[model samples]
Target: MLCGVHNHDLAPNLSGHLLAGRLRGEEKQRVIDMTKSLAKHRNILTDLKEKNKESVTLI
Candidate 1:
């Protein structure tokens, strides 16, 4: 939701739909796109996490 933060992981409904395998065809493709976008976002989050850890160690 909110642009790139397709944090379906943060909500139960999206996870339920995904796990249930209820989505079909284009709907599934749409979900895949959303998940891929999230994966890209995750890479940034991981970098930020590592940077945060470094900053904490420096403190």
Candidate 2:
């Protein structure tokens, strides 16, 4: 199931690379956008950890 979804998602990237010459324009932009979004999510998690530094206690 996961493999199918992953393959479906990868189809466009593979098509773009094979059909076209290189990963340019939207493809590159999409990679950059996804990277930035992931970074932002990581940052939010870090910030949340800092905010709860004194409150959070492990059992």
C-alpha lDDT score of every prediction, in listed order: 0.46, 0.46
C-alpha positional error of residue 47 in candidate 2 after TM-score superposition, expressed in Å: 28
lDDT of 2 by residue, 1-59 (tens): 57546544444333324444344365446546756777565554445445444323121
Candidate 2 Cα errors over 4 Å, as ranges: 1-21, 39-59
lDDT of 1 by residue, 1-59 (tens): 77868855655434334444343365446546756777564554454446444221110
TM-score of each: 0.28, 0.28
Model 1 Cα RMSD, Å? 16.5
The alpha-carbon deviation from the true structure for residue 25 of candidate 1, after best TM-score superposition, in angstroms, is 0.4
Deviation of model 2 at 1, angstroms: 44
Residue 57 lDDT, candidate 2, scale 0-100: 19
Clashing pairs in 1: none
Give the root-mean-square deviation of each candidate in angstroms: 16.5, 16.0
Model 2 scores a C-alpha lDDT of 0.46
